[model samples]
Target: MAYDLEEQEQIDVIKTWWKQNGNTVLLGVAVFVAIVAGIQGWRYYQHQQTTQAAGLYEAFQGAVEKHDVKNVRGIAGQLMEQYPRSAYASRAAFIAARSNYEGGDGKSAKAQFQWVIEHAKSDEIKDAARLQMAGVLLDEKNHEEALKLLDSKHGAGFDGLYADLRGDVLLASGKSDEARAAYQQALEKMDPSGGYRGLVQLKLDGLGG
Candidate 1:
């Protein structure tokens, strides 16, 4: 309506500034909105994947409970192929590996263990997979490979288990002295009162350590 002289000048300056920079401001706002929406979409997609993987994992558990090794393996394959990034995928693979190992399918078990070693998100999971793989190798009489694998760096809390397995591999390989040393290390690293400690002690005693 009516503007003082100074007010009119200020308004003019604002109009000039808008004409020069309005398009840039609009573009920046649009890009920001797009980025925010993209982030929300990505989050939603991740949530959906986690939910679906959880459902599949429940099914995998049911099969495991029923001792349906075939179904367990098939579902594990699907989880691994479709939701490789999900925690369920690695857990499923771990279960499948154990199932195969127990069922005398060392080939499939070893393959799954290798997959976990390569793809597991958790250090503990990778360590467990490595240990199971060593067991498979020991069964196959691949003592040297098993020893080499056990020698690899393990995560915290796995030192004792690795040492125990190392002892087993050494004993199997006819290295009684080394086996005794490994078993002694296991006894030292393991929990003082853990149930497994007794077994390790027995092994050591068997070797007269």
Candidate 2:
């Protein structure tokens, strides 16, 4: 083909520009492709993890419902150990703790509760673990330790329950006046429409409020 002088000049300039910068452009494109691929790979891996964890969680639930303590411990332990980053792990810990507590294994129950308190990403779960652990300590007659556990900050929604548990610990320790005060705080914090308000009032009445 033939080109006019002006057209040839423009084509020459484009060729020169490509000769100087084409490698950099290709490198940039390659890097972008690698990054996109990497991101997709990571997303796939996370999805697989969540799917596997969910399956394990469902199995744990079945074990719990059937009162299969051995299977519950085994499956829950696997979830906590292998999938600790999953949401299922925290829930598994809670279920395992309750199961252990019910089966008269307070030591294991306390350990599982402590794991949830230490590792749970959710503040609500941690607060629930702390409250349950305090109850376990109270059952063991470790009054001071129970009180100490209940003394820590709980989630805003747990304030009333925390105060109520604290009152129970105080009452157990024979601190009647402090117990009454805690009961009053619980009542104040509790939502009037909540069922727990009635329970808290009963505790207050028991304390001669």
lDDT of each: 0.96, 0.94
Clashes of each: 0, 0
In terms of TM-score, the best-performing candidate is: 1
Lowest summed lDDT across 10 adjacent residues in model 1 is found at: 147-156
lDDT of 2 by residue, 57-165 (tens): 9999999899999999999999999899888999999989999999999999999999999899998999999999999999999999998988898878988988998
In the range 131-156, model 1's lDDT, one tens digit per residue, is 99999999999999999899999886
- Provide the global lDDT of candidate 2 against the true structure: 0.94
State, as a TM-score between 0 and 1, how close model 1 is to the true structure: 0.94
- Where is model 2 more than 4 Å wrong at Cα? none
Residue pairs with colliding backbones in model 1 are none
What is the lDDT, from 0 to 100, of the residue 128 in candidate 2? 96
